[model samples]
Target: MQPLQNAGYDRAITVFSPDGRLFQVEYAREAVKRGTTSLGVKSDEGIVLVVDKRTSSKLVETKSIEKIFQIDDHIGAATSGLVADARSLIERARIESQVYKITYNEPIRVDNLAKKICDMKQLYTQNGGVRPFGSALIIGGIFEGESKLFETDPSGALIEYKATAIGSGRSDAMDVFEDKYEEGMSLDAAIDLALDAVYEATEGKTSAESVEIAVIEKDTEKYRKLSQEEVSSYIDQLVEKKSNDEEETESEE
Candidate 1:
């Protein structure tokens, strides 16, 4: 169907318009941009993930809304776009991990787990009347004594990343990552850089209360989401650092 008036394009997933554009697919990608931002950074010791968790209403339970998930002891993920889609994909991943364990008597590698999810997402695009998932995932974990990170979109295209950001404010977050990222960063440095990335993305609009963070470490038993108090403390430290820097600039003047 020619969905947009005066625009010469069909807006169906199964059909490509005259301009060689799939409006539905493009719409899904835009949905990811409109959703909350999620970021991941990979380092020698672990992976750090961050998310903006702003809610529209006060009545909703903030704790019940999960922007990040621990898929297994060694795997965790962050989502940008529809939370429902992300949850379904994550559940599928959990089942796939279990299946692999049952069949092979060993845990699935992080790369393989990411591949399986990407394959599942790709299957939808090839089928008639199916819409690509309106979500993107950044998965990170410790596997085979090393840390790994990956990003995948609704198109089922998956790629490894040293650092990546997605969803709303992604451009700003990427700017921070590009400026700060270094190879072989310690876990602590990664976490701090992740915070800076989040801050750059949500600058002037969000606070610690509306942020979510998690870490998957090589030495840790499982993925861990930072507590609210811990997030608050980190925010405070960042604020203090900024204040000090501004004061130093004034002294220089």
Candidate 2:
């Protein structure tokens, strides 16, 4: 196709170089890793999405910067990477959800919606006219009393995770998920786990002011992004939980 950015491997997204790598897709993945970390956890009761929302500049409209969005009454997404690209994808998802309902007169399944957006992402790679989205989408939703969570990447691969972390410090976040994730966890436990994952990712950089939390509970209303006070309360509770656990460990020792 056109001249690549990296000269050798970085060309069309579909073209694999001699190394058998799609450099453009890798670049998109790297772009995602540069963003503030976002976490998603699914429990029996519901799903939780947590995001570290550090702005680039004081001039940036803090009020306008949101990493989590309500895709439909039942589905929501937490995004990382190019914020604009994520916004476009989120809007597309919203429209797709509406279109699906209008066509079938029923809510689209969470898995189906995830695949639809991912397939749309893959389309850009096949055509030289466009570039893959430099973003990762973590969608969490409840459909028919079952909670589901999924993460999708620039290469259009969709993966389901009981708990998933994307963007910066994902490796650290994953460790937490591996340790704490349990089947049929309560909403509070899932939220605590999500908060702990974010803490690991940010190395404690996150705070009520710099982070946002959202949840889609058993209620039928929709995804609810927590306010500053709500986030602070969660943080406070998490701190207390950790403190109690440590004290118990010391006592046992």
Candidate 3:
């Protein structure tokens, strides 16, 4: 055999070689965990996602900021933590939708778009197992002959819901939602119910200042972020009515 020299040793060493690619393989289990905070509401009009704007290293610091975001014309997204990751994913979804529209000669439906989002989350998890920005997503749109709503988790799992809530105060939110939910409720009634649910969920623990609301409808296929003034006014009226009713009950008693 030829004399073994430094050249043979270098060849034997697997530093930055194509065959060493396996070493770079990332497992999904190694990914970092994301903090969770977010809420979603669905109604006859469409879907709405409400999130607080505050971000903190700890959940205790969540405050009012502006966490709700529009992903595309017909899509809205909200996050509880890791705002940057949530924004990046939203942007990616917008671009993908545009691409699909141009290439496929048709607009992407909500279901297909949700699937795409889940796929992206999977790819992110697979590629070196990056931690997803800890933010849940609520996607709303009209598709398959009906209005649709989808809730997705950081791990890419998704489910359809007629009306659902997620995040820190989701349990309270759901309770309030059920109290007001009526089958085939009118659009206005549905909007009122959604606002009430969000308010009840955040009340006592957080002030109204910490809340943000957005609405999507089947005809518009767009998310409209409600003005702070508008939301406050609506809530104020509801609170007044509730107080009045409580007083009336006390008098009767």
RMSD of 1: 2.4
What does candidate 2's lDDT look like per residue over 1-253, in tens digits?
6455536656443577765777788889999999989999998889999888888787886667899999999999999999999999999999999999999999999999999999999987778768889999999998988898999999999999999999987999999999889998998899889999988788866667777888898767368878888889999887787779889999999
| Residue 221 CA displacement from its true place in model 2, Å | 6.2
**Candidate 1 lDDT by residue in tens digits, 86-205:** 899999999998999999988789999999999998887767777888899999999877899999988789999999999998999889888889998998888888878887788756
Please list the C-alpha lDDT of all candidates, in the order they appear.
0.86, 0.88, 0.62
Q: Could you say which candidate leads in TM-score?
A: 1
Candidate 2: minimum summed lDDT over ten consecutive residues — where?
4-13
Error of 1 at 165 (Å): 0.6
Which TM-score value belongs to model 1?
A: 0.92
Worst 10 residues of 1 by lDDT: 5-14
Candidate closest to the true structure, highest lDDT: 2
Question: The CA-based lDDT of model 1 is what?
Answer: 0.86
lDDT at residue 15 of model 3 (Cα atoms): 29
The CA-based lDDT of model 3 is what?
0.62
Candidate 2 local distance difference test against the native: 0.88
